[model samples]
Target: MTYCVGLLLDVGLVLLSDTRTNAGLDNIATYRKMYTFEEPGERVIAIMTAGSLSVTQTTLSRLQDAIDIPDGPSIMTVDTMLEVAEMVGAMLSDVSGKIAGRMGEQASAARASMILAGQRRGGEPRLFLIYPEGNFIEATSDTPFLQIGEHKYGKPILDRVVTPETTLEDAKKAVLLSMDSTLRSNLSVGMPLDLCVIPSGEQRISERVRIDAEDETFQAMSVAWSNALRRGFQEIEI
Candidate 1:
């Protein structure tokens, strides 16, 4: 399991994902769960995935193969972000079905889900949560965020703080603090984290940051958030 979150704000988009994947107690490992693609001045897309590694990896490989072909049904070739989400959802569903078929219907481990966030040259930026069956839900003004994997522990802050009016800088802090909360509570999710920002109308990624366990800034932020939480808890009336 892992944690991946994306925000579609009025200013731009923010994305974050953990790199941890584990099979069992002794099989812990780090694997990148975030992917980005861009044609500067044309468009940009970022994907954060959670669930079966095989399904996600194979689905991405197939998408990459399509991306290499001109005029293909790849994400880069899509005319709108909605089309891109449709293409991705179909690919994910196909790959998942194939894997689950091979492993028998009883194999629950073959499931996977992904969050897709991006913009096309002439369209509004969009965020989607693609489910295992080739369907997805888009982010709306009322709910400007989408999340996948181990989400419950970190959702509170987002529910309280995120909105269409959030600035890109504040959006970053919200996601980092959200991820920090998850990291402290869930053993399945870990870092280094992959974070990226795509400012509206830039048609490309403007900033990308990788935060590891040893990073001082992230450490300090985590400590600060922890202390704030403690103070808030103490302030509550009994």
Candidate 2:
């Protein structure tokens, strides 16, 4: 299990995902869950995945193969972000079904989901949460954020703070804090997070970062959030 979250704000899009993948207590390992494809001034797409590694990896490979074909209906060549979502959903569902079928009685282990966020030239930035069955819902003004994996532990902050008008800087802080909350509560999700930011209308990734476990800035921010939470909890009269 892992934790991945994306925020769709008026100014741009922010995405973050952990690097941990675990089969068991002794089988823990690190694998990047965020993948980005960009054509600089043309378009940018970022995918953050959670769930079965096999399903996600295979789906991405298939998508890449399609992209290699000139003028094909791949994510890059799609006319709109919606089309990109549809194409990804179809690929994910197909890969998931085939992998689960081969797993026989352990089909549940092959389940996977993804958060897709991007912008095409002349299009508004979009965010989507793609389900395991090839269907997805987009983030709207009412809900400007989407999350996957070990999401419950980190959802409260987003519910209280994220909105379509959020600034890009604040959005980044919000996502990192959300990830910090999950990291504390879940052992399956681990360090060295991948974070990406795409400013609206830029058609390119403005910021992409990898935060390690010992990163000073993240450490300080995490401590500050914990302290603030403790103070808030104590201030609430029982």
Highest lDDT model number: 2
Structural similarity to truth (TM-score) of each candidate: 0.97, 0.97
- Write out the backbone clash pairs for model 1: none
lDDT of each candidate versus the true structure: 0.93, 0.95
Write down the RMSD of all candidates, one decimal each. Answer: 1.1, 1.1
Stretches of candidate 2 off by over 4 Å are: none
Say what the RMSD of model 2 is: 1.1
In the range 122-148, model 2's lDDT, one tens digit per residue, is 999999999999899999999999999
Instruction: Name the Cα RMSD for model 1.
Output: 1.1
lDDT (10s digit) by residue, model 1, range 10-50: 89999999999998867999999999999988999999999
